[model samples]
Target: MKNRVSRWLNNEQHLAYSILIPGCALVLVFAYLPAIQSLRFSFLRYNIKMPGAVKFIGLENYQKILADAVFWQTVGRVIYFMTVGGLLVMLLALGMALVLNQEFPGRALLRTLVILPWAIPPVVNGFLWKWILNGDYGALNGLLYQLGLIQEYQFWMANALAALSFAVMTFVWRYTPFITILFLGVLQSIPGELYEQATVDGAGALRRFWYITLPMLSNVGAIAIILTLIAAFTVFDDIVTLTGSYPTFYDATKTPMIYNYEMTFGMGRFGRGSAMAYLIGLLLFALTFFYIRMSLKKED
Candidate 1:
């Protein structure tokens, strides 16, 4: 026993295991532990009001969720936001980044201005836009009416499409700068020689940009897309404020985050809420996994 213990103690494998202990413990306590609890709660008919009265409901919660028409609608809304809105933000960010990388007057100041929206808090941004986009007395309607562009003020958020558009606007306004900065950092690292070669070969500005600048920026764009996907999928604050959590049926623009919030906290359906939360978590986990895999492939 002593010989075996001594051999194990002297092995480098033991040192490696010791080093991983803290990391493993951290993941267990923070991530896996909470996940397990949530999963268990999802199987029960639980509510926060009646703490000790949880009853096992098997897959009833999942069944009910699948059958609910509203559940599918929210699912569609989330996909639209994550795919279409997220792509718009990323494309705008890339354009801004490329423009800023070129020499121009007050370039530094312009870049600083572009980053202000991203620096502000999400809730604050939501409220600010609310004031600006209000139907009765908003800056947008006020300006347009004064300019004689319309017969009267338009109600921007009274409809689902308008509200969703503004939500996407707010997202792009706040997050495009992040992509801009990332692209800027990557653009700076690219040697000027590539551009010089293109110029020497008589490539025009458009050709150089299309071939050289864009190809060099692909990795940066990929990183930006991953970040945008995560944010778009998990978004809560901005959308909540822009459109109240429980709007009229025709005005329902709820995302997965909103659904989770309403079920868990608002309606007090803890078990069902827990299931929705886990569903969102699963989507995030899969997105991150694929993102990392694609990034590794690019590296290779």
Candidate 2:
């Protein structure tokens, strides 16, 4: 038995398995176990308020969700936010990266300061923006009034479009810095030789950027765009903090994440909520898979 134990411990494959087993177990317990439980719940009729009434309902929850008009509206809103917010983030990040990549005094300080917004916790960032854009005594209102831009303080969050647009701006402000840093790092990694070669060929600065910089950054750009879209897709705390999740604000700012919270906790419809979670997870997975396929094709 002693000899057998020694052989088992000495084996390379056994050693590798031993090293990985704990990490794999932790992931299974912490990540996948909950997901599996949620998937099981998705096919049932479970209510938190009436736990005893749990029963198998098959795909009824999914069917109800698919046919729900409000769900479709939320989907449209998510798509809008993803497209607009993601585009703005990428554009702003790229521009900022270009500017920051240039040599300048205090460049290091500026780069460090730019990361501050991204470092703020999501909930805190939401609250900060909420106060800044508040109708009464808001910083924005005061600034605009002081500048004589408006006769009176505007209720920026009152109108649906206005609220959504502000939310998008806030998202861009918080996320752009991180993406900028990402692009900046990629920019710094690029070979200066390529630019020198292009210059020798009589290529102008714009042409060098267009031909070399843009092409080199394409892979990271694709990743950043998808990540921004994913973040926008599941946005919750920002809208909730900005609009307070009041019934009046639901139509204006409720994303799928907010709707899921309402269903699971507010309405105590656990099963339906689980189904919604699964659906959203599937959509996110599809987006990630699409990104991977595009990336692989690009490499090929």
Candidate 3:
């Protein structure tokens, strides 16, 4: 038995399988199993409140979702939110990465400070920004008023546009630092000799950045953009904390996750909610698949 076990462990393929088995089992149990169950639930008329009414309803839940005007509107709103928020986050992160990549006094301390916001839990970040943007007694309004930019405290969340903007701003603030760190590492990996050679050829700062920096960071930027796109679409805690449970703002600020939550818990429509969840997952999967394919094609 000992000789047989030793030979098995010595075989590379067997060893590889042994190492992978646990992780694969864990993923199967934790991730894929729940997803399969959710897909099953999506086709049934199961409600937490009405457990006795559980019945297989085929694609009726999905049909209702597709035919709902509000669902389409929410889809549009989420797309808008993802676009604006993702762009801002990527830009801000790239800017920070450039600045932090340079030598400066107290650069280490500055880098630490830059990462502080990203380290905060999403729920905490949401609550912190919510307090800062509060309409009647917000610190932002007070500061602007003090600076003479505003005559009085502005209700930031009362207006749909302002609320959406605030939500995006909070998201950018929280997520930018992580992307910054990612880009910073990429920047550091780029040999300084490239910049030095560019300078020797009489390249100015902007020219060096345009040529050397952008090209080197292209792959990293693509990955970062894809990640930010995913995060923006799936955002939930930030919206919940920023907007609370107000029904009035649902039309303006609801993303797919928020809509799913409201349907599942708020209205006790588990079947429809599951259907929406799977639909959103499918959309994300398609987006990611196409993006990865495009990136691979570009590489080729």
Give the number of the best model, judged by TM-score.
Answer: 2
Instruction: Report the C-alpha lDDT of model 1 over 1-300, residue by residue, as the tens digit.
Output: 999877886899996787799899999999999889989989999999888888999888877777878778888887888887788887787788878988999998998899899899999888888778887798998998889987787778766767777887888788888888988888888899988998999999999989988888887677678878898888778877766643662246688788788889988988998888877778899889878976887798
Error of 3 at 13 (Å): 7.3
Order of candidate numbers by TM-score, starting with the best:
2, 3, 1
Positional deviation of 174 in candidate 1, in angstroms?
Answer: 1.0
Residues 173-232, model 3: lDDT tens digits? 999999999899989999999989989999999999999899888887887888888888
Q: Write the per-residue lDDT of candidate 2 for residues 189-233, one digit (tens) a residue.
A: 999999999999999999999999999899889888878888899
Candidate 2 off by > 4 Å: 1-15, 294-300
Q: What stretches of model 3 exceed 4 Å from their correct place?
A: 1-23, 290-300
Counting clashing residue pairs in each candidate, in order, gives: 0, 0, 0
Name the lDDT value of residue 129 in candidate 3.
Answer: 87
Alpha carbon lDDT of residue 99, candidate 2? Answer: 92
Write down the worst ten-residue block by lDDT for model 2. Answer: 245-254
| Clash number for candidate 2 | 0
